[model samples]
Target: MTHEEKRAWIRLIVAVIAYTAYVVVILRRAEGGPLPDVPYAAALLWTIGGAIAAAILAEIGMAIVNPRASRVIDVRDKEIGRFGDYTGQAFVAIGAVAAMLMAVAEWDRFWIANVIYLFFVLSAILGDVTKIILYRRSVPTW
Candidate 1:
């Protein structure tokens, strides 16, 4: 696999792990209380911070292990990157719309924050997945 492809895989894995960690922590604290009462802001912040750190560490480790293998960035890579970015941006819009609807409905801040966070994670996952698939298969001409 190419270096970029490996990076995509790393992102996918990190996104999943980070999201799962956030959910697990929230659920553990949730107990039997109402959903809005669950402590989520700290968990959300931690997961975001941790995910960023993990991603950077993973990239550094990958670079250190095989310095020569990770240097290439070519035409195909750029194209795939753009495609993946465009694909992922859709989710951000969706998330914004969801948050707007929640606000209109007078939903709790917890729900609104969680929904936004979830959409960001989904965007990362979807973008990474798109890049991975594009790397594996030929990008179709449109």
Candidate 2:
């Protein structure tokens, strides 16, 4: 696989693992209690930070293991990246709008924050999946 494809795989794996871990922790904390009152901010922040760190470390490991892999970017990489970014950004916009509406409605901060975080994680997964798919299928020319 290409370097970019490997990076996408790494990100996808890390995101899934981290998000799952966060959800599990939150659910356990919510046993017989309201989810909104489960003290999720720390878990959310820690999971996000851990995911970022894990992805970076995994990429570095990949580079170390395959020292000869080309790091050079070409036109295809740019096109695929643009396509994936656009696909991912749709969820971000949706998340922002949802959060804004929640705020305007005076919704619970917990709900609003969780919604935003969920959307962001979905965006990453979708974007990484798109990039991996494009890499496997070959990018189409416009």
Candidate 3:
């Protein structure tokens, strides 16, 4: 694969891993148990550490694979990114509408939150997949 393609795959893998970790953490928190009190300072430190680690790993991975090109995101990439953002927003809107309707109908369920989260994830995945498909099918520019 080209360096750019390899970098993209690496990024996708990292994103999947990070998101899976986040989901697992949330699930663990949801399980009924005596939760330890998290101090704000400790929580802030943890958040910062996680963010820094993730950012460093991502940057290093991309730099190692595609040092020059990794620093630049072209117009096509920006367009695809915008498309993804739009898809995410659409998912959020759909989830909000569903929640509102359910509330109006007096349906209360804890699983609704999970459904909304899944909707967002699925929407993002679909958007990325669609963008890749389009990129592959389109004619190349000179």
Q: How close is every model to the real structure, measured as TM-score? A: 0.96, 0.97, 0.53
Which portions of model 2 show Cα errors greater than 4 Å? none
Off by over 4 Å in 1: none
lDDT of 3 at 96: 78
lDDT of 2 by residue, 7-77 (tens): 98999999899999999999999997999889999999999999999999999999999999999989988
lDDT of 1 by residue, 1-142 (tens): 8988888998999999999999888888989778789878888998999999999899899999998885679999999999998999999999999999999999999999999999999999999999999999988689
Best candidate according to TM-score: 2
| Models, CA RMSD each | 0.9, 0.8, 6.1
lDDT order of candidates, top first:
2, 1, 3
Weakest ten-residue segment in model 2 by summed lDDT: 133-142
Model 3 alpha-carbon drift over 4 Å, by segment: 1-56, 139-142
* Whole-model Cα lDDT of every candidate shown, in order: 0.92, 0.93, 0.55
Residue pairs with backbone atoms closer than 3 Å in model 3 (clashes): none
lDDT of 3 by residue, 1-142 (tens): 3333344444445445555665556556647653332122333334436645875687687677666664466777666556645655777788778877776776644445445555655555555554555456642354
Residue 90 of model 1, lDDT score: 94
lDDT of 3 at 118: 55
Tell me the lDDT of model 1 at 4.
89
Give residue 77's lDDT in candidate 3 (0 to 100).
Answer: 67
